[model samples]
Target: MKDVNFIFIREKIASSYLYFISFLGLITITISLLEIKIPSHSTILILLLIFMGIAEYFPVRFWRGTSSLTFPIIYAMSWQFGIHITIIAIVLVTLIIHLHRRSPIQRMLFNSTQHALSLILAEWFSNKCMHLLINNIDMSVLYENLISLLLFCVFFCFFNNRFYDLLMILLPQPYSIYQWYKKTVTVFLCETFGFSYAALMHVLISKYSVEVNEITVLFFFFPLVAISVISSFSVRIRMEKERLYELFLITTEISRGLTGGNLKHIKQALKGFFGIQAYGIWTKDDGNWNLLLKDGKVHFDISDHSEKFEGISKNLVFNDWKTGTAPGDEIFDSVIRSLVYFPLIVNDELVGMFVAGKSRTAGFFPEDVQSLATFSNQLANVVKTRILISEQEKRMILEERNRIAREIHDGIAQTLAGVIYQLESAQKKYRDKPIDMQQIVEKSIKDLRGSLGEVRYSIYALKPYPTQQLGLKQAIASKIKSLKQEYELDITYHERGHARALSFSKERAIFDTLQESLQNIVKHAQADKTDVLLSYQSEHVLLRVKDNGVGFSLFESMVKTKNEPHYGILHMNEQAEQLGATLQIDSSVGKGTEITLLIPDSQTRGA
Candidate 1:
């Protein structure tokens, strides 16, 4: 940047040959004016000025650089009106060119002066070549002008391009000087061709103005000009389409990366596509936006007044954040200096945003704005989808934890309680019979081992396993088999109606709930018969677990909230709610206990 500013000052200054050949040309003009009087070709000079002005209006821009019919027109003027008059004409053209291009005064002076210097050199060489060729002092008119024009073109192209190349060498460019030289090859060729053709046109117009039939050159020249302009624009348009096609592919790849729930991919994509240094994605959840930024990229020093960034404005892009009227101007300007903010739109509503800082001083282009408008919308949807997935995972974790809690409460805890009761009885009766105490101790050891096995199984309940891959009916039957084997109870399991397809998460909740129910029967029922029924209805799946046991009062257990309430029931209810289902518990002191789980259809569940 220091070198860049130095180069800027060097190019702008007007005193030396270091930055500008134009300065040398100006000095030459002043020297020439002091030594000689003004030449007598005022009419031709005026016409050249008019032509240069007209040519400036529709200068054809090409693949490498911009050019016009003015190049040849000026070359013709330089050869005919002589160096003094031609330099004036060339300067007038430079004024119009600078005005049309909106260049600074320094650029205006440099370009105008450089072109004039090249014209003078080219004209002098052409005259010298003509004098040398005319050995006999009489040559064919066509051959004489053609030879002179050819010689003039060589000098013209060399001086014109090299002068600018020299000025470029004196300045500091981001690229190497050799790279600039390689790039200007096409520019040199185009200007050479243009200068030669204009010279021919000057000869043709001068020789055949009155002879209407001899004006055939105009036909070929006009078509050539038309083709040059048309071809230049066609190539430019085609290249732009190809660039956009590549951009589409790039953006598509970025969209795929965004869908996978990685914030880094999103940041990298947006940064590379927009050619920015940093980006921040802000998404709203329950009316609060969570800001995402790269690690160690931005210092989070802003205050909690982030609500100031609501309601972005729709306006033309402003290069500086402070000058722009985009929503959340402070976020981009005060909190963090960003070049622009691209809004994330979903369903025609502004949902979130991502900001980009320009890699260069020129800032974001309008075409870039249009492209990213569509891109931002897609990004917002990806963020929304990721949030949903993450939340589902969290709910699944919570449901699994609850299921484990219920398994511990119903199985291991109850088994230990019964063992404790037996041990108490043995302690109380130990003084009467030592043999009875030893047998009681053996019974308690057996009870404790069974409880340990159940505890191991409870721990396994917490381990991740695919519940949906195994059918719900088969899974329930497996649980009942384990219960029957462990307790030596006559437990029967049955199913009715076709099982509906459920997501893996939903099946997990249903399976865990059923397991908890069977464990409750084994621990608390103290019954001879236990039955489990799974019935899949048209709109909902119904599961029932019944036990003919010493049933406890549901109201009494539920009312005691200080740790005596049935945690198994509470867990089952939570699992049911998550599945958009209901749990029903029916029990009394003398009657059997029955528990039912009702899971609804997808549509009903969604509601």
Candidate 2:
């Protein structure tokens, strides 16, 4: 629940904060430029600035954020050449790096300003500490500088992290205190490692000649760069693992059912993990493309791009509008500069289409497209399953209508015909035999009462007592009794263990599976006897429906189940999956077909 007023307030605060940071940064840059002096060691200063730029360019990224190896270079310059040169170096490197990243002007200014201010204030504080130490203790100049450098590094790390964390906290998005603490700890560790390297650089510059120090500085950065690259590689590996985990979670959620919340999770994952700005999911129903989920500023109408969607196969289709050569630019909003389109196909039939895009024109990474494609494959199954379920339900409704019609003809219709005959006879007897007419009228009244009872019974049987009133056990018993009475088949119901309460979803799944199984047995089993068992065990609940019937070939039925609308077993299995339960079917020619549903108690329990 994010309210409009809260969003407005957060936006106002963010805007004000960005403006203030940018102004302060610009002022710091101006003052630093005013105090600038071409130092005597200009070559060394140039070399340090170049290294700073390189370090900032290739930052080590983590799941939470990113870190750069620029601290050592910044500290070395700040100690050797003073604040003005260090400030100018930091500002220039920050600008170049941010510009390369296509960052907004406000963000670039804020980043440069924050880094510049942190370093300046930390340097000032460390100088005060160094002066105090020098006055109180009889320490060498080398020791004085070393202590000051350490203090600067510590203060710098603190200020940098504090400013960033404060911004995150003030933003509209959620940022927990626990997450903040973890991020702070991580930043501290990285800074500690960086400053340790800076310490070595400081000692060398102070003790060695300029030529030897410059050479050492140049070669020293090789290992530093190597470390950064290795850390980046590790981060990438970790990120991939995290994505795989996300995929698993998404699959689990969508498998439950087609719901708004499930679809929202997919949309959020795309935006959060892959930086997609716009997306649309469309399912093709009855030869018409219908929008299922959409977000951002996507302008894709299936009607407008029917040919394009029709042409898509197993491969992903994408375009980068920035290239000015990609097709179908009109299908997207101006803000969406790059996009990917994947067809959701199952059983070689296109069931749905997925489209996602980013504002950046560079388009999606290959691996990202691959991951999204796999997700769409999962989504394809769900869409297909939903379609099948809908068809199955429609068929069931028709079958029920036909059954009711037959019931009317067999019971109520015939009973009403008898009542009409008795009424006609009573009308005739009213004039001829008044005594016999009274008896005929009584028989007609009795037949009408039976008809009303039959209608009431049918209505009661349709109620969802499995989840609402009678509970699953009683519902099963009622269903078994109804089947026995209607088909005149020998039916047995047994219950074991103490029945515990189950979630509505689990109960519904079990009941629906049972209904499908019973319907199949009555229609096709050609058996004289049927048995149903409900067992509540310590770990799980089990339901078994067995019929002593002339069973069909299990192998052939499975083959048809895969390709055709064999909803009896297919629907049962789908319900089992939705409940996170297992459905096992066993049968052979001349042997009884047994259908068993096992639901783990952990899944059956209410949330």
Candidate 3:
């Protein structure tokens, strides 16, 4: 439920302007009574009053909205009847109109009083001008009547419009009065035609008073004038409707471009539809305007200046930048006279701005302001959507990298290290005899060949997630850069692999195990230099991380993990189980730590 009592003329001037107009109305009525005589043709006054009352009942649609037949009838009545009778008739007719309108008591009083004042002013102006333009002549003479008639008609038109303007100055509204003045010019032109009809009718009646009485003339002609006004109004409404609907279709196309994230299409649409000299999209970040896009002949560098927006208003259509009171007066060059600004709001937040400049001969109308604002809102929604998509893309890329690295570490790297340990032990046992060494060599060769084939297949299965079916080297390179930054260790990497493919899970396992081993060296080993090697043999794929630093015994490290339950060793063992690979740890009390993972050449080994 809206409270009607909350109505405001503005933040200020409600009481003051009301009293001021009332005072002026009183003075106008007093003057009309003191210096005025009643019209001899009182019937003419009655008929005109009745006509105005009927006109008010059925207001005609004219221009963007509506206009009344009351103005022309009132002007003619003021010219024919004397000020005393005419002023009284105006008050009676206004009361009838406002009472029927159900307008508030304060508004009805102010409006009716204002109309009375302008009418009295018009009457006085006509009488003074008539006396000055022509010498005193008999009221009966035709030429004298014509001279008086012409002077009164001119004054009637001038004072009627001017006094209406004067009444506006006493009130206040949210938007600037100058903006309203610009918006209402078209309506003013239509009203001019009505006033022209009033003047012509006044002249005719004054000229032909002898042949047909004023009442008889009025009875015949009033209906014809009413019909003409209504007919003109109907035509104007039809044209306006067609124009507005066409604008809607064009704006819909522009909005479509915005949704598709086509900046070029949006720019072209704005220029083609609006016919603007320049258009710009500006965003405010930390109170500075950033020019995101500019279209058309953007001659001035106003957007580059921080001072341009200072002391500027939030009004939609404006030309006030020329005023020296504004902060950046230099931005408004000679050619730029008018600008329309629309605030780009998204989700109820004023995030940015949209502004356009008009051609030299053209200016921004209220209709243009309304239409452009709609386009700006659609653009805001699109811009916000694009920002979200960009952020989401970055997040997804990071997650994919992590998944690939984890798979390689747990499978291929673990299996190769265990095969290397078995071959090293066989070397120690077969050292005493050449015949026994031949049999050991035969078994080791067979083991290496089988391991190598499985490692190749695993790498091949991880294709499309890396460089040429291999990302272990690339993943390791990424970690090396980070480790060097985090610690002062000089690390060297070597690869000895003919194998070039591995399964995604094997790739992830190998990557993760290598990462954990290097991280342990950084945190626990007092290493000055570290060696990382990837060796592919006939039976297996192997990875090694050896550091030259003060190191603890392998037994003591395992004992700590068993009692305190650290995740590092537990995680490595879990990954080894998942990949069916082997992890090995070698260290001495004074020497550094060495970690190796080995994968064999059987597909089922890490399945």
Best by lDDT: 2
Tell me which residue pairs clash in candidate 2.
none
Compare the candidates by TM-score and give the number of the best one: 2
Query: Ten-residue segment with the worst summed lDDT in candidate 1?
Result: 329-338
Better of 1 and 2 by TM-score: 2
lDDT of each: 0.64, 0.77, 0.63
- On a 0 to 100 scale, what is the lDDT of residue 65 in model 3? 29
Stretches of model 1 off by over 4 angstroms after superposition: 1-70, 76-117, 124-139, 167-172, 199-221, 259-607
Model 1: per-residue Cα lDDT over 329-382, one tens digit each: 444322222366666666665556666654222345455666666666667787
TM-score, predicted candidate 1 vs. hidden true structure: 0.50
lDDT of 2 by residue, 316-413 (tens): 54443532333333555654556787889998999988877775434475677888888889989999998899889999999999998899899999
Alpha-carbon TM-score of each model against the true structure: 0.50, 0.54, 0.42
Which of candidates 2 and 3 is the stronger one according to lDDT?
2
Clashes of each: 0, 0, 42
